[model samples]
Target chain A: MSALIEVKNLTLKFRTDEGLVTAVDDVSFTIDKGQVMGLVGESGSGKSVTAKALMHLNAKNAVYSPESKITLHTENGPVDVLSLKTARELKVVRGGAISMIFQEPMASFAPAITIGDQMVEQLQLHGDLSKAKAKAISVEMLDRVGISDPARRFDQYAFELSGGMRQRAMIAMALSTKPKLLIADEPTTALDVTIQAQVIDLMKDLVTEFHMGIIFITHDLGVIAQTADKVAVKYLGRIVEEGPVREVIRNPKHPYTQGLLAALPKLDDLDAPLTPVAGDIPSPLERPSGCVFHTRCPKIIGDVCKSKLPHDTQVDGSHRVACHLHTEVPA
Target chain B: MSETLIKARDLSVGFKIGSGFFGKSILKAVDHVDIDIEKGSFFGLVGESGSGKTTLGRALLKAVPITGGTAHYADGEVDYDLTTLAGPELKDYRKRAQLIFQDPYAALSPRMTVRDIIAEPLEVMGLTKTREETDARVREIAAKCRLNLEHLRRFPHAFSGGQRQRISIARALVSGPKFVVADESVAALDVSIQADVLNLLKELQRDLKITFLFISHDLSVVAHTCDHLAVMYLGRLVESAPTREVFKAPRHPYTKALFSAIPSLDPDDRGSAQKLEGEIPSPTNQPPGCKFHTRCPFVVDRCKVEEPVLEHPGDGHEVACHRWRELADTLAA
Candidate 1:
């Protein structure tokens, strides 16, 4: 499969009033065509920051490392995302080749504008389409996403629709641009379970039909298990473990990943105790010295975990984990 | 059986919506709900948004006005009728029951220190007399909730989501309430922190012997934490049973669909569970019969015309569905 996008040594920090807080530290990953890469992490795990770095969507206070690089392969050629400074130059990476859906559908949409108008505006901005054609395409996309009476819903405001319907509308709008890569940041977190299931099914279908690469970012391990082919578990600002979904979930290598899996309330075995990762995630300002997860690691291997960062050890053909438990110790 | 702490029969909470007089309509947020909470039981109430789970919780707490039916609070010492409860009786009930809000960030005041937030409830109820007494009470509850005594002087803004939630829990339990209504208390926290909070709640419930009414939308969470579970849809109680019983064999279609929709952790188990179609109907313009008829996969003709009452087939499992028995047999076949 052809590579859709590649991120290398991408370290991001925010210039805050107190100090420079590192958000994403040397995070690197690649998305292949039609593959779903699930970025799993807790609130401060930097999953969202890594997703935003792909589209250059972070705030003005954000700073990127000098060695950071993002290359998006398009029909034309390989486009360097960070090098594209101007809005005109960045358009190809924005809604043109990459589209994003947010957790809160209401916040993403304009209160005053109709759903149809917003969708058509997006399509027209990205491609050369007439107003009539864009409107037709938007309605078609809405119908495709399983919104009943799509034509009627096109004219309705975002508030007029239910939470489920609004989410479906947002998905339709995002896909209307026909982008190669879709970045869904907690898209189903706001919806009910039934609605979330429907949205997940729709996204899976869209992936196959359009053959588009998707970066699904969420704190929900269940959602990640269902939707993603590959999973990257993040802690603090580092990718602690990266592997095939089945391998990572069934047999997690990193202590942090194991803690997360153990923490989830399992259905098959309700008697299994919910073991939460020990201690609160330290503030980003006072990041741990060696491994980011060592402070809370259950199986601490002597003083090595506290002093030096562990290198990524290949577990299998496709699986990789960065933890002292997996890495070889020099005699 | 253990002592019934709170008992409700056809308890309903209604609110007037729309405009003045003629244009106004009553929105029944909690309708004809029957519940019995035994002392020291962690009872769970689960439903989607707009399903009146929160309304039912608040109604039981007397936070919302109970418009119809009867609710009794009997904790051996005080047996007061909740519907007609007022004056000193109501004031006393405030000390007996408390609510832990859902959003920890928004629930705690940004300006108030952790100590003051937890101490406010004690002072309001006049549980402690001297300043030292209030401080002593606050410190004890804070320690029970697993909060740092040093951090009690710091404002809420300095703490994380998990710590703030603990502060809220401490505040709710400071008055030494026998009953606590934790309304989606851990929904806002991350998964790792969510487990931590849930464990803390379970520990507190066991230690203090507090009858907890845990309200949440997440089924797996309720499954693990609660002893008894009640499933709600559009202000109606569809099913109520022990946690294990409900998970092992869910009778109501809505309950089954809710369990199915959780997105299994096993990747190989995808799409095996039945998915409910369509969104929940608007409460204002609800269907005439069963509220779940619109989305239920096993919905029959009888479901659209007449609402089914709760029926006990055996054990403590209560289900409200016309074809639950037949559906159960057929699924087994």
Candidate 2:
């Protein structure tokens, strides 16, 4: 299986009033078919932007480097995502090949229209279907997402449904398109614990049944561990560490990853105090030279970690980390 | 030893719903509940949005009026019934009880400087006679909250969500309150910044000896911060126990589901957990018997009509369930 989506040397910047605000810097990764790769980071880490760049979803002021290339694999051939100029040309990439879900389902959905209408509209965009058939398929998709009374709910407006139901409807709409890749941006962050659990199970089951690759983005490590097959930890627009979820959580090579892991409150244990990463996360405008994480890294090496960016060191098969300690010590 | 500092017995708070100003029907925000918060304890009230835990906390703080039963607040000096709090005595109660709102962005005024926001509580309470005294107290609380004095001159907009929360904590503490209601205080913050705010709250509790009613939907954050936990479901208390005990052996079916729902921080721990089905019923049309019976997996016919009363079988644990005896046997296995 070829790489479903490959991002090589991707650097995105926005020309602001002050100066160039670099959002994603030299970020490169690949998502194979049927794989779930999580992009984990706090705000300003550019995880969402990198996910959005797959479909060239950016402002007019946004600039991508000449070397930056986002290639998508298809039955026909490979297509550069950045080179697609118009909606017709980009249709194969956006909504056709990839579908994105946002944190707030209410905001993403059309308030005036019924949920079925939105799902039908989405289906109509990607495929040709009659009105009656679209309605039947939309209702079926709603039921598939575990929405009860699906037939009756087809006519009810978005506000009539609860938060969890609305989110399920959104998922159903996104999946109705039957895209190859799903970009879920903090899908369960705004939801309750029980609702979150249900959604997580649904997503996992959908992944198994649909056999679609997913780019799951979130700040919560716990959700990533449970939902994502592999994980990439980001700090200030840079990938500090990338590995399978189990490997990264159990034995993290990067200090930033370790700190984040320690910060999470475990249900199994409660006595331990939350140990925060020392020092504040620097403003994106004042990002540190060399390693972006060196400003807050607890295990920063002498001058090497400060002045020079550490090259990627292979910690194990498929696990790589960017840290001077791992690189210099030859881990 | 009088372990309990605040106790509410058969507390019920009602709100008039729909129609005219008088309204035709009453909605019970908090209904027939009993709870005991230990002296100087960090107590967690865990539930969903319409769980009534927030209303219960507000009722305890005298922020909302109590309509039924009684709540007693005692701390060495004199005991005051929360329901009948009136006149000059109520003013005293305001000083002892303060609330830290959920959204720091909405809670603080962007127009006011940090110093002014922190000092407003002290001034309104008339705790300090002069501005100098207020400043001194404000500065001390700010430092304890890990806020710089230089930043005090800046508006709330100048600070991040974490820093604004610190300022909120400083304000809540500046009143020198005995009881603090932290209503989803850290929910607005990011995962990494949440740790900093939690640590700050813990440190303040240690130094000030203030009891906090930490209300949140996030169970993990509550488990890490609170000493004791009370799980609420649709205006009712399902279970109350020590943090370790509740997390370890939750008696209520709702509590069990709450724990199981937490997406495991450990990757290996996934797939083994159970997920809950159905949504929480609206408080206005709550199901008879057990409020959670509509969604609970362990529901029987009897659970559908008879409301279970909170029964204490010794120790610090208390559970409100008819099937707890059967559950204990299965859970212990």
How does candidate 1 score on lDDT?
0.92
- Candidate 1 has a DockQ of 0.84
Tens-digit lDDT track of model 1 for A156-193: 99999999999989989988988999999999998888
Q: What is the lDDT of residue B267 in candidate 2?
A: 87
Residues A177-292, candidate 2: write the lDDT tens digits: 88889999999989998999899989999999998999999888988999888999988888989998899989999999998888888766677779877666777788798888
In order, the Cα lDDT scores of the candidates are 0.92, 0.89
DockQ of each: 0.84, 0.73
Q: For model 1, how does the per-residue alpha-carbon lDDT over B242-283 read when each residue is reduced to its tens digit?
A: 998888888888888898899999988887878888888888
Query: Which portions of model 1 miss their true places by more than 4 Å?
Result: A329-331, B20-22, B330-333
Q: In model 1, state the lDDT of residue A114.
A: 97
Q: Interface RMSD for candidate number 1?
A: 0.8
